[model samples]
Target: MRILLVGDEASLPAELSDYIGDLGEEWQVQTVPDGNAAISAVATSSIDAVIVAPVLPDLTAATLLGQMRTLRPETIRIALIDANASHRPPSARIIGMAHRFLPLPLAPEVLLEALTSLEELRELLDSPRLRSSIGRIEKLPSPPHLYLSLMHALEEDDDSSTEDIAKLVAADPAIAAKVLQLSNSAFFNNGRAISDLRGAVTRLGLATLRDLVLASEVFSAQSLSTTERNALQARALTASRLAAKMLPESSAQLGATAALLADIGLLLPGVRNEHDPAEEGDDRPGHAEAGAYLLGLWGLPMPIIEAVAFHLQPQRSNIRSFWVTGAVHVATALASGLPVDEQYLARVGVAAKLDGWRNSANDLITLPADA
Candidate 1:
């Protein structure tokens, strides 16, 4: 199998590459820093499968996967995401239908299963029903052209002007309206409404706006159900608030992005779907693993990817970076609602000191919420 792995996480690439190498001559692999580069590589090369982390240094996994489907529809995609936190309904809807999602803590068995699943997807690729499914999936829940433009504007060099970003937001009335609506939601709750894109941009800041653009594209009316929609809104709002309070010293801008999309794994119909009676083993395998597989397909960053993969299995505990997924775990659980198990909290405490998986678990438990 020829695989293209796009992510900058120092640890995951090494581990994944080594694992593929151990699979012997049948498996070949290549690595890239972000989604855009991954797209270029795919255009010029032959890739059998693609694995991506959601929160990349330069681009998001969902954006990249959307692009890849346009360039090469045949390649199987697998997302690597953190599962400890919850995600919004729209993003979760996007992820649920992905070819595969692998979670963090890198269980060799699950990783192998994900790889094998790609082989299954490839076999089914030519089927008429499968082809139709892929077609619908390829259509994208959001308007892709507009989304890519907004992403480019927000992630431009720090010296880039906010005016350029404001112009991008202005270009899309629907997107602009969504942003303003979100800004005025009880979550943002600025005492007064400004009624303009510029005001929304200024108050939310570029990073928050960037995150919202991606979110709004997904959350369009087609994406939500009563329960799934409410869960996403609750998780996004709560996680963002808690992450801000917890990671005050950290400069990484994905605090809100991480929180808002944290529980995306749950929204996937595959993971949440009712179990088949014949399949006796755990129906979803693991929510985090399912999410990671989907995120990997989208080509997100390793940090966000890992957080999606390992949100539930804190005990699995082998993450490569603390900045992204670990922080996500701490902030996500606080936002989602605490575990019913006291022992779970104590276990989290022990892991906090031993594994250093973001000490915020302690504070998350203590404060619950900040004034």
Candidate 2:
């Protein structure tokens, strides 16, 4: 694997190069001292991944990463920032550009693990046919207009009210319907149906409602057979609910959101519909990566993006502990007809917890009868 290190740090390049060299001769590490050189390298080289410092000589890390995104959309991007940098949150532009953030006073093992994880994920999705198919997807539908309006309002003023957000959502009938449906779904378990947009908005809160808007917009963008759309939506809701039950409270919301959008790759242009047996023999890109690529472009949270990307093969993830990817993986398997990956579960040391999760998932009403 060819990894690029972009920064002007005098000592970092040597230290990182030495550590990466220990991984084996198959790993090639290149160091560039500034953003211009980094961009030139990416444009000229087949770099697999990049680790960039927060500050670069010619440009900020965000600008460098943004250029990288345009030049090499497939290359994995990691932000290597100072540990103290976490005191202030990253700008939205930076967050949108990088796939992962590492607090650096650097740990060799952690960096190695991140690289290894990216390598593993790449291996899982190495099919040339899949790459060709995904490459053909020129554009994805943007988030709903109402969602954009709500975001703009919130950004223009820190204290946008729920009423204002709800009013915006209500202006779009399709979005309002989706918000109401989700609010009343088993995932919420509110005991009574939510018929009003304002009530649904309050029930879901701004963060979750925002995620739902993105998901709903993506799903609605394409024209699908009613059966296929319904099936996909039901499975997503089931997986999301199960994910909420499996992950920690802090991460559960993001996990659910990830699960909700896990199969979005299926909607990308040129992908065959798995629901149609006639399309079984057709070559299509893996839905996980396609979905992640779209979400990454849209600047969703990295956890949600990674979870969607790796849900199909959680064992490839570098994170050893339970995470959104694991929950979504198991939930997706249970929601679909696929068998849960026993070996992956064992490797992650979560095999013991599966049966209980399976039982709970089975009882969820969102699951289809066949599932």
- Local distance difference test, each candidate: 0.58, 0.74
Residue 227 local lDDT, model 2: 73
Local accuracy of candidate 2 as per-residue lDDT tens digits, 186-292: 76746987778878888988766876675566567556676777688778877887888898889987888889889987877776544345455555655677777
Model 1 spans > 4 angstroms off: 1-47, 50-148, 184-192, 221-223, 248-251, 273-282, 320-323, 340-371
Alpha-carbon error at 25 in model 1, in Å? 6.7
What is the TM-score (0 to 1) of candidate 1?
0.54
For every model shown, the clashing-pair count is: 50, 0
Expressed as tens digits, the lDDT of each residue in 1-371 for candidate 1 is: 89888887652557778788789898898888887889999999978778787678877777787777667666776676675531212364445334555665456666676776555433322233333334334333322334556664446666656666777787778778777777676656669986877777778777667666665554443446755554565556556555555454453555555555566544444444221233566433344554454444444445455556655544444543344455556667655555422244355443433223234434332211111
lDDT, candidate 1, residue 269? 43
